[model samples]
Target: MASNAFRKELYVFERGPEGKPVMAVIRNYTERDFDGLIRIQQESFPPPFPSELWWTKEQLANHVHLFPEGALCVEIDGEPAASITGLVVDFDPSHAEHTWEEITDAGYIRNHKPDGNTLYIVDVSVRPMYRKLGLGKWLMQSMYEVVVQLKLERLLGGGRLPGYHEHADTMTAVQYAEAVLAGELRDPVMSFLLRCGRTPVKLVAGYLEDEDSLNYAMLMEWKNPFIR
Candidate 1:
């Protein structure tokens, strides 16, 4: 992959006097961007979320070494604002059940497949201050562009239901997912993904270790419309 597989100047957006739109650069991350990504993970997932679960230099380096095209980052005013990491997988939709650790190789993404038909999004990190600025959808779009460029069949990943823990007692994980789908509930990650055009395929348990999602997440996918 080229060093600059994809790069775009996107205007950061917000409303109601919170801020003005800032010119931001969205492009693939290199080795030097690892520490900034770590800071992003720190701000993105705060306390109670294990800091050890965050990206390490080795893992980030592995990402670039294995599949440089998949390691992308967003910069606003030359600071790392957000990033999305993905790896190709020759996926079998019939055998989609797998833990995050199993598929992602614990975020090291050692299982990356260059000839794979599906791009499995491993992680997305954004500094807390960059949240709610429509960055997630752009990141999703960036990956979707990747899928299209590679002629991949689809973009797939686990979408966390961070809001479910608050309603766990009232509903099963599946039911909580259904509620979110039906517009009866709002989940930070799930809702954001939905707005970004991903559809929930099913709910899976032990998808990842997250206090908010209770280790449950929705198996989501977005098909490439340009393909067919």
Candidate 2:
């Protein structure tokens, strides 16, 4: 069992296979969750994404050690189903061009800053089996709540443009993103993010190694208006 120090939570989700409502538990991940986290990462990002990009034991450990509050996990039926990892950083929107490694300290979150005003999301993945359960949205909401509770300015992430590759030949990454926002195009990542209340700030390149995204991503952010 994990410690109570972490923010343990229960979120009711859509009905399960039996047509009965199910409950998912959200909480901070610990050292023991490394294997499960690794499994999910592989399941989420397969061969083309580069196996080396997967989470390392050291990275997972550093996440919990440096900032337990930012390390989140989801459990359904006592099994790890999804996870989201992030760190706090002092973000400058005007000068926001950066690769994932620079922002997240190579996934170890060694760059986490407690006094920073932004919650920088580094990774979010859900098991294929539970994708239909709406766990992704719930996980994001959990992080948004963290931003509100910490009195942060906003929550942000370099969201991959997974559907960009399809339109890459005819349009630029920025144009593709704008089209998605305009409802003229539907991108898996961009559409899901928009539905989650995140607004795209700009299109960034070299954000990560997602071939489907053509190594480009849109910087998305959700401001915490209640933070004064």
Candidate 3:
């Protein structure tokens, strides 16, 4: 955590002329534009899910204020173009063994443990059509503001990672975790974070399973005080 004064500041710039990107502070989940959010999620993800699974207005309203402090949305010309969702949850080192669902519901942060000191970035997705325009960087900067405001010491959770166990039919979870963490291959999400001045705090061993699965976990924490 940095100085409270430094953390509370906001940095604004015109991203475009007529289509200026609006950096809307997301206070409640209902304020999240589900249509745009779902589009970005689907376009950025494989094994695309039905829109109804996540895009319902009821779901948004139900969880909108749960993490109201850290959620944010980036709008383009009055339309939501990108969104970043996170929370100031306690981090439990023991939860490393927990399933994603378990972590999602009863994880360290959700349980309000005293040892949970890190900020949890749940989802950071930008529309595929809006890639390479610095929107991701902008959203990340916004996330920094939220973290600084909460005075959190570290960040944790599964960021985007490389494809898993592509060539192998069966492999140990530890082996797959090592491959991704050791940089056996390039990961676009990790690369993006690095480019935006974020570095890994720890690459947890046995953090992910490798069994013809496509998703792998990437745990990164912000080191610098100012990514604003």
Q: List the residue pairs that clash in candidate 2.
A: none
**Reference-based TM-score of each model:** 0.94, 0.92, 0.66
Q: Which stretches of candidate 1 lie over 4 Å from their true place?
A: 1-4, 17-19
- What are the per-residue Cα lDDT tens digits for candidate 2 across 1-228? 324344566755555665456677898988888899999999998877688888989889998888888888998887789999889999998998999889999888888999999999988999998887788888898899889888999999988888899998999988898899899999998899899999988788888877889999899999998975
Best candidate, TM-score-wise? 1
State the lDDT at 20 in candidate 1: 82
Instruction: Give candidate 2's TM-score.
Output: 0.92
* Alpha-carbon deviation at 132 in model 2, angstroms: 0.5
Error of 2 at 140 (Å): 0.5
Question: Mind giving the per-residue lDDT tens digits that candidate 3 earns over 41-84?
Answer: 77766464444434344434433545555456666555666776
| Candidate ranking (TM-score, best to worst) | 1, 2, 3
- Candidates in order have lDDT scores of 0.87, 0.87, 0.54
